[model samples]
Target: MRKIRNSEELLGQGDIASRRIVLEIADRTLDRLDSYRRIRSIMRMEGSVLHIGTRSWDLSKKRNVYLLGAGKACNHMAMAVDHVLGDRLTRGVAIVKISEETDRLNKTEVFVGGHPLPNEEGLCASKKMIEIVDHAGPDDLFIAVISGGSSALMSCPIDGISLQDEIDTTDILLKSGAGIVEVNAVRRHISALNGGMLAKRIQAVGAELIGFGISDAVGSPATGDIAVPYAAYKSTPIGPDPTTLDDARATIVNFDVADRLPKSVVDYLMNAGPDKETPKAFLDNTYFLLNTLPDSCIYAKEACEEMGIPAIIVTSFLEGESRDAGTFFASMAREIQSYGNPVKPPCVMLSSGEVTTQILDNSSIKGHGGPGQEMTVSFAITAAKTKGACLLSIDSEGTDGTTKVAGGITDSSSLKAAAGKGVSLYQSLREHSCFEALSAIGSTIFTGNTGTNLCDLNILFVPAIEGGR
Candidate 1:
């Protein structure tokens, strides 16, 4: 992370410059939503009927093919699979909350579902997904698309569990500030569909499982997800302060107390025990690291450089509570503008990572703001009130949270909205109400689902001119 120095002077055009920085940030974030990198990761040669990951089986025997996908990126992954090897896919189904409105796959059916919270709709689809993979013959192939929001969006609870229980546990884990590992650790035990629950399902179906993960978690497949991570713990949970969402746990079904999760899943989560020797069915399949956070960070950084600004990828995963992380990022931007040490005069300290906002008060409201947008505005307010630096943050996916405002921008004028409304910026943050401030001024960025989930991005732009009108 580089720092830049700031010496305030009255620059009449400062506002325009700030606006450019903000728009550029939004455009660049959306531009990277290209599907090529993803398609390439899941793509293969035409006519190559052979499996993608290492084959656990001897190549001599031919196998039936059955495909299944579950997650925000699953359907898209399914589309790419069809492109790579069309007509080969026997049958498949996918779950995507938003994209299902238009996702059209020749062989795969797209089911619309909810996110951050699973609904009856998603649970129902997940059941059929299990059946698709379950019927795979010992010689059949199963490709599971595990991505960022899969845990919640693709919830197919076990026989004894209810969707409400899954949601409740999520609430408890999130409010507890538990990292994705602990959260998922607990989730693995609660659901019959996660923590290798699906793998176990595949085994029973006698299918060879090939997981294609669009890991939304920080550590990629190491956490057991290319996009979900069931293998690594370098993850720092998004610690939202004390919240009311804790109530979500009150619904867990009783039998969840003791369930024997797939031993392989448990061992993998513990980061111990060797992988299962390929059961005769899977003797022909294995896993692969198709993508990770670093890939998207590099892409964003290059775009910033092209804009003629110095760029440093601060961190691939800046995980922590929103307020604390916001404060830390605020200080970093101030250092860049006032000191010019880690980053130079005209630079954008770009960042990509996850942040969680706990249930502050369910009794109140959804707060009209997402943590990503709040962070951008929060950093701007914390930036020494000087005239040089500008901060803009956006969820790469286009939808930041309960509110659809992808993200927001901050500059000297950010405080104006609240002041105009006779509400202080500090008060808004106290209430988690950045939307009231950012939206009033038209600085909040919005682009319906960018279709890419590399997590969120924050950019701090240091300036050549410290003062701007």
Candidate 2:
């Protein structure tokens, strides 16, 4: 705990208490995320569905454990699965979005695919997964691991459209500011592996399927049922910004590949019909939500309060488009500095949620940034002369995008750093290079992998000003 001031009343009544409560809840939520660790904790000798903690369950006698992972924690989940089921893990395959691949699977094979959009790699990976699923027998166990970035990473689209079409649709939805549920709704339509599509395929193969899910969305249902086709169906009114297409193109490939198609995914999309099925009812053995954003929000809030600063948790979960959310947070921070409406001086405002960044296409252009840190940096630059105001945002899983740093942090030094480099803060922000801007100034927070995934956390602090602003 980093106490920045002195006042028990403020500690108990004001922002500190609010922040502490939020962080406490966040921490408790985080405890559930040890599910991966629990999988590792339970040896094959342990009973079926052995409980390690609340919501953390494992099965030792899962005849032939098959690993199917997609998300930020996919590799971690695979590692944990391999650690426990070593020889028992007869086969494994997981996909990470392009450039999002962090760790190599311990005993499992890992594949880097696509995200925010699908690409050639994603298609190939999907084919490989289908092959693996096709091989599962009745007694063989299929552990389907899913997380936030699964849609793009585990994509296997319908027959007529190319991966590029999927990518274009994704771009439209992302720019529209549609929520994950809504985005995934349309995504599930053309995607062969979305909704319960993958599970249905496994069922077709006669494999006993068990799904392990980690929710980045606010409410974690059985399997993000509402998320499958929500975005495409209910695209947000948010219009597009003038962003370069080069960045997005940099990691994608598959304007046109082949005329090949998996009969299962294609038939499922058509025969099962888009509107004919519910999204999440795909896997019978399902465990949703190992950790979530609210959990991280509470934990960070508490830690802020223990430091003696005033803190308030305005929202337990925060979600939406990355840039828009960042700008909104900047306004809230400014308010705390000037008027002190929601929270007073010497305090921190904390929140958590999954944020999506519109991956721009780039050829000659070059930049780097992620939702978390970019939000913080952008907020700091937008600060209305609140000299001591500091904001920190981080992705709980350690890596933010393709970097080692979790995200960005901002304060007076940010302005100084920008000025020193002879660059305007606005320019860095406009370039969408907040990650590098902060990293160059040595302001990015790095916490490799906390062995937990709790969405994202945002911590904002306002030190006592000369006259309380």
> Which ten-residue region of model 2 has the weakest summed lDDT?
234-243
lDDT of 1 by residue, 1-469 (tens): 0000011221122366865764565466455543434555434653444544323333234365555666555555667765555666677777775774545577777776677667887888888876676556777776656556767777865545567766765655565555555565556544556555566667776666666554566654322223322232221111111111121122121223222333333333334223421111223335444455555667667777777666888887777766566667767766666677686567777777787766534554435777786686676567646565677677766667667666766676666644775756676677777787676665676655455666777777767555321
Give the least accurate 10-residue stretch of model 1, judged by summed lDDT: 1-10
lDDT of 2 at 166: 74
> What lDDT tens digits, residue by residue, belong to model 2 across residues 363-439?
32257777886676677666646655666677766567556666756664467656776756566566767776766
* Backbone clash total, candidate 1: 44
Residue 226: error of model 1 in Å? 11
What's the TM-score of every candidate structure?
0.77, 0.72
Off by over 4 Å in 1: 1-14, 22-26, 33-37, 41-45, 48-64, 100-102, 219-284, 364-366, 421-423, 466-469
Q: What RMSD does model 1 have?
A: 8.5
Clashes of each: 44, 33
lDDT of 1: 0.58
- The most accurate candidate by lDDT is 1
